[model samples]
Target: METSIRLEQAIKKLYIAFHNNHLNPECCKQCAVGNILDNKDSWKHLSDHHGSLELNYVGKVHESFGRKFNGYSPLELLKIEAIFLKACGYQLPFHHKNSKPKNPTHKDILFDGLTEVITFLCELDDVTNIMDYTKLFEFKNDKPLHDITEASA
Candidate 1:
């Protein structure tokens, strides 16, 4: 099967399974509290003048970046993104049960950001070894698998 089709199918199954009821959170309070960590002032401070802080262990490094967001460097942007991802339960320490999967034990289901998942999966597959990029991105040269069939070459 084409990578795009397979990806879509896999994602559909994942969502269907999740919707049927299968996953749950490992740490409700931690995840929830982390969700709204906007107020830096209330956080446990770590730095001096800059007043930097640690959001979630080593996974996130929140810093002032010395200027406004527009002035953020590449490294600083990376740091900010990392913190947000961890806070949003992306690279979570534990597996949460899906409250809506057919197979409640199936934790592979994800409801948001298939592109990110596809990208990560491609990485985990070790891109150098993947001859079939078609089966990785779940898209055919940027277009979807179904669209490929529906449209002509």
Candidate 2:
């Protein structure tokens, strides 16, 4: 399957968000989920998996969907966002609260989300055969660290 530019951008943004949250959680307070919900310009290129289904109201309409949280943490919101994004065919994964992590830490939530994003990208590249391996290396070596989660200008 030929990958779309939109998907490519989305995947890159996911990576950017993951590193941003990992390196500076304070700056990226909301992380990827916050970026998805609050920033329309950045995420508008990505398409929804379920057409006409409002993300905010998904739990209300679908019995399988989890209920909304009034004051959820950034990690919790990220998991919910992953669920909806995955349902929309983005290859994302929702980390259920039930799963037991091996090594628990204050940053465990961010790490879990990062793992999902990387897995999604790897699977996407395997299917589409479009990933540039060197770009990741370049990103690691050449890209200056920044607090902003958005891709380098």
Candidate 3:
């Protein structure tokens, strides 16, 4: 179990977790994310899952076909999350959210930011609770942690 700080990887984990019943719409903050991942088109305020993404609705319709794969732009996604966490009141079980650094880098910081998110999710459900932070391995390539079979077998 390695800590997974990569945003794409973290989203991958959530996508897998949601599909596998490790997460529930009633508990997790990402049901909308899962909906987008699954290619469903729907409009609902962020309130149901705890209202983390209502970043000033100036007629910006947030919909994704799940074709784009990555649910939200790294910057957009993290900001929405901050809103979610703020709405959640930054209380017990979830660690206090950190203000993201302003310096820019091509490398994604959202990945690193997910550690706290996973922690927050864990506080909400069964799937998140068992997420071994150590199991999130990192590699600098486009390869799946290992060949598919090698990883599972």
TM-score of candidate 1 on Cα atoms, chains taken together? 0.24
lDDT of 1 at 125: 33
Q: Per-residue alpha-carbon lDDT of model 1 for 1-153, expressed as tens digits? A: 334433344345434434654222222211111111221232322222111222333223434333322333223323333332343344522234412234323334232322343344334334432223464447668776555444356
Between candidates 1 and 2, the one scoring higher on TM-score is 2
1 or 3, greater by TM-score: 3
Q: Candidates 1 and 2: which is better by lDDT?
A: 2
Model 3 ranges off by over 4 Å: 1-80, 83-100, 103-108, 128-151
TM-score, cand. 3: 0.28
Top-lDDT candidate index = 2
Tens digit of per-residue lDDT, candidate 2, span 1-153? 575453455556555655654322222234444443433322211223221123333333332344333333223444445543443333332233333234322355555554554455445445533333343444446674443346444
TM-score of each: 0.24, 0.31, 0.28
The deviation in Å at residue 38 for candidate 2 is: 6.3
Highest TM-score model number: 2
RMSD in Å for candidate 2, one decimal? Answer: 12.7
Stretches of model 2 off by over 4 angstroms after superposition: 22-29, 36-108, 118-153
| Model 3: ten consecutive residues of lowest lDDT | 103-112
